[model samples]
Target: MDHYEQQALRELQQWQIRMNKKPSLFNGLTKGLQNKVNNVIPDKIHEIMTSAIKNIVRAALLGSEFTTKKEVPSGLSLAERERLVRERLRFYKKAAATEGAATGAGGLFLGLADFPLLLTLKMKFLFEVAAIYGFDIKDYRERLYILHLFQLAFSSDARRREVYQKVLNWEATILEFPSLQAIDWRRFQQEYRDYIDLVKLLQLVPVVGAFIGAYANYHLLDNLGDTAMNGYRLRFLQQITITPK
Candidate 1:
């Protein structure tokens, strides 16, 4: 293997270790707190949020609305493709941060609007990233992979490990499901909502909400970008045979 690929493989290994880590005491405590917060939230609101995520994600998977016009040029190296991916990620992070700041400053009503807007931005970014990785987002399987990556990035430690294992054996796992309808979207939405609920609640407050919103959105995107890079790296490296020296 080339120097850059070797470096990428090492990084992927470290990420795998992190993905497989057991939840710590702190993780358990935070999860408990988040669950309490979710419990206090009205079931109607939870239903609304879950429905929104399901519809938006389903539309993204089944439609071409988020597809990029720029094709990944043939024969680009992994390093080259990743450079473009990073550039796109930075752009999306800035856009998300800006959206978050604007909505946050406008009080609770606008803050509520951030959910769909931010989700669209994230899904769009993933589509662009998939293209850069030379994956055909037009394929349903690839789109499903995007959802798994999203779950991996935002779910709690235990759920993250479960999703990570599916990602690791994606080729086999994909076959077990007959269609996208087989996905447990209720669990998916709940995990994602619980994951972001704490920080997102702060965005509803007056004055300081703007700063919190911007920081949270940027940080979230940054985390997702790293997860996506390593997720794709796992697939890429696994597809090619690397001889040990």
Candidate 2:
């Protein structure tokens, strides 16, 4: 090991410690817990989702501002941003019909930014878009429960089966409404189970879901993976998976 390599390692460690010390980094969680989970999963998903969504939102906001504050940022020229967002919206919408609002990151942002009512509406809209692509989200009550499960399970760096059980624990509470209250459990449960499949898809898909899970855990826990560890893991996987002709 050379002096330069050792020095770089020390610097990276110190930087991580410094980041841990910052309260906003973990968004108020204790340093110990942050060390445990890390914001690896959610953070990555947020990064990609935000990058995709922000531009779309920026386009809409800019469009609205054109009549007032017409000036635009240097890199994000209004015309260019608009074009890119439109393209993204189209692609995502094509991926699944219930995904229409999910098509444009900007549109999702706008929905979230508007208010609680709008937030719920936007969620419903996302489900609708998914349905358009042949995904079922017709069970509102159960769909809500599934969403809660997703939020809780991916909300931290926990084991998959462990988190899944935790989600199931909420079933009683979610089903408390009597049949007389007009909430139908049989139908809703079926649909909710289907939505669970969607959530799992986002968590387990090799590149997309795994990266999201890693990013979410990293950001949530305020810790970075050992780069050396990551490199070794990748090499190991490649060695095992690749075969000579």
Candidate 3:
């Protein structure tokens, strides 16, 4: 490995160590406030958001339609895989930024529409990233890994660590991770929505909405893309240690 690849591997190891560590006291406090906020949200809105997010994610996990990701050339090295991943991230970031700008400029009605549209963009980008990493998204575990990456990005600090541990243990459990419906969809949706609530809400305001939407969506994609790259990196290096030479 050259300088960059060695540095990346070292960083990935450190990241996993951080991921596996238990949440700090500050994390607990933040999550507590998040819970308080979630509690005040109307049950009807919670139910609606939960139902929508669950259905959309379930479709991504179980439906072939979501896997329209074309085949990537196989047998790329770690550096090559990440190079491809960066390429995909660049494209998705711009698309998300543009979508956010358009919807944000359209006022509250269209700003509301950005939620689902942006979700679509995020999911599609995950599909492409997984393919570039040489994983078959048709497999249930890989799809679940995609969801785990999503949760890692947007969940509270406490849940993010928990989710990352799951990602680390995935290889051991992927074959037996139970049914998709077994997940706590309510918690998943609430955490995600609450995490982005304030910023996304700004996207609904007049005049400033367009800038907030574009900037928020752009950075959201940036964060998600980074999380995903490390996630796949974690998997790749772990497999390397186990593979028979």
Candidate 4:
């Protein structure tokens, strides 16, 4: 392995240690708070939001309409590909911060609009990163991998460990994934909801909204970018033990 690949492998090993950890006391408290908040939200609104997120994610998983660029040449080195991936991430982080600031300043209605808009930004970034890593986003399996990356970035501690295991051993689990309709989307949505609850709630407030939105988005995108880089690094650099047919 070359120097850069060796550096990446070391980073991936450290990330694996983080992903395998159990939830801490702080995590337990946060989850409890999320449950209390959920209790206060009317069932109808909760259902509507969950259904919307699920359908949007399902559509993304099945379609490549978001990506205009084709996959890179197969001959590109891992170092070269990761350099391009980092560049894309820098560009998208600016975009996300911009979008977040604009919507955040517009009061309640526009604050709510950030949900789908930011989701689109994040997904589009993931598609670009996948293509940079030479994965075809047009393939459903690749798209599913993208979703796992998303879950890994944003889920609660318990859910993060579960999703991390699937991604870590993806050569086996990827094929075992159930049909799209079978995914527990309610849980998916809730875990994602709980993860971002604190920062996102502050994003709805009046005077502080814009600042919170910009900082939150800038950093969230930054986090996702790092997680995605290491995710693909782990997948490509690790040795896979293929089962016999």
Candidate 5:
């Protein structure tokens, strides 16, 4: 391997170790508390929330709304592709922050609107990142990988490890599922909602809502960008190792 590839492999190995680490006591307690809160909610409410997230995400996966026009030029190195990925990430983070500020300034209704809008921005950013890494977003498996990557980013510590395992063995894991419908939508939605609920709730406050919204969205995108780069790095480095010399 060249110097850059060797460096990337080291980084990917570190990320893998972090992904596999067990949740701390505090993380476990927080997850327990969230579970307790979820248990008290009515089944119908859970169904509604899960359905909403499922439909929105499914639509994004199947629809053209997030499709990118830019194609990765053939023969670009992983490092070059990641440079473009970082640029797109910066652009999306700014857009998400702007959208968050605008909606947060509006009121309860507008603050509520931020969920789908921010989700759209995130999904679109993932599509662009996948393209930059030379993955064919048109394939169902690739899109499924995107969804898992999203889960890995937003899930709680314990759940994150579980999702990370799936990401690590995606080729074999994907074979076990017949279709996207097999996904645990309820768990997926709950984990995501729980992860951001605190900051998002703050975004409903009148005066400080805009600032909180902007800051929250920017950091959330920043986290996602980091997770995505490492996620793709796993694939990139693996491909390099397995390819014929």
Candidate 6:
């Protein structure tokens, strides 16, 4: 048509192109993060969860004898998720200062008690929180898939395999354990009833828990492993006092 119409058409086409590129751009970012974990700082995978003080406390408090009575959902609520991460970091720092200890080389022996049913409840909580904050996910499915990939890839295979069997060990007590397919739902509910209650309580705060949940889900379930790996790699990169000629 005219010059003005041509300009408008060009702008519209540019917007369309951007919209089309969005998914790939997001996936590329996700993949980049995943690569850092898979290739660079592979050791940092389980360290994030276990090297913290709160984790030890939870393990001690929950005890090896604890058992769930129902199916526990496989995610966390927002506030609880935030609390979980913050507490873990806090504990990690305190442990480091007090003990001068660090996450041991090679994956630590993590059992169901290590990851905990609370973490799963926290994940589900995060989903609701994201929704409350008007967060939409074109690439959520991709992120979730990638999260699983990271979990599977960087995780200690021995421990991973052990936990898979333990999921069966508590089959009656815990519900819908994370497997190739969803396990029993009723057990999942009973297993994480406390976490569910906490999620419900946090819901009373309107979108506060939801906001925390959204970020935690995006970070932990989506980006934490890769982020931790990247951080470690960046640290190593910065350690070069001199470059080779």
Please report, in order, the local distance difference test score of every candidate based on alpha carbons: 0.89, 0.33, 0.81, 0.80, 0.84, 0.31
Give residue 151's error in model 4 in angstroms.
Answer: 0.7
lDDT of 5 by residue, 1-245 (tens): 77877787777778778888889999878877776766765675455446667778888677776678976798999889988998999999999999899999997778878877888888989988988888988887888899999999998888999999888887898997678778777788888888886677679789899999999999999999989998888887778773211
lDDT of 4: 0.80
Q: Highest TM-score among the candidates is held by which one?
A: 1
Instruction: Tell me the spans in candidate 3 whose CA falls farther than 4 Å from its real position.
Output: 1-4, 17-48, 242-245
| TM values, all candidates | 0.96, 0.23, 0.87, 0.91, 0.90, 0.20
lDDT of 4 by residue, 1-245 (tens): 78887787778888889988999999899888888877875565465456667767877886656764655778788899998998999999999899889988987667777777778888889988988887878777787889889999999888899999888778787677665555667788887777775676678789889888889999989989988998888766753331211
Estimate the TM-score for candidate 1. 0.96
Please provide, for model 2 over 94-200, each residue's C-alpha lDDT reduced to its tens digit, 9 standing for 90 to 100: 33322222322233332233222222332333333222222224444434433433333232323223333433344464465333244343432333222222332
Candidate 5 clash figure, as a count: 0
- In candidate 6, stretches whose alpha carbon ends up further than 4 angstroms from where it belongs are 1-22, 43-118, 121-245
- Poorest lDDT segment (10 consecutive residues) of candidate 3: 236-245
Clash-forming residue pairs, model 4: none
TM-score-superior candidate, 4 or 5: 4
Ten-residue region with minimum lDDT total, candidate 2? 223-232
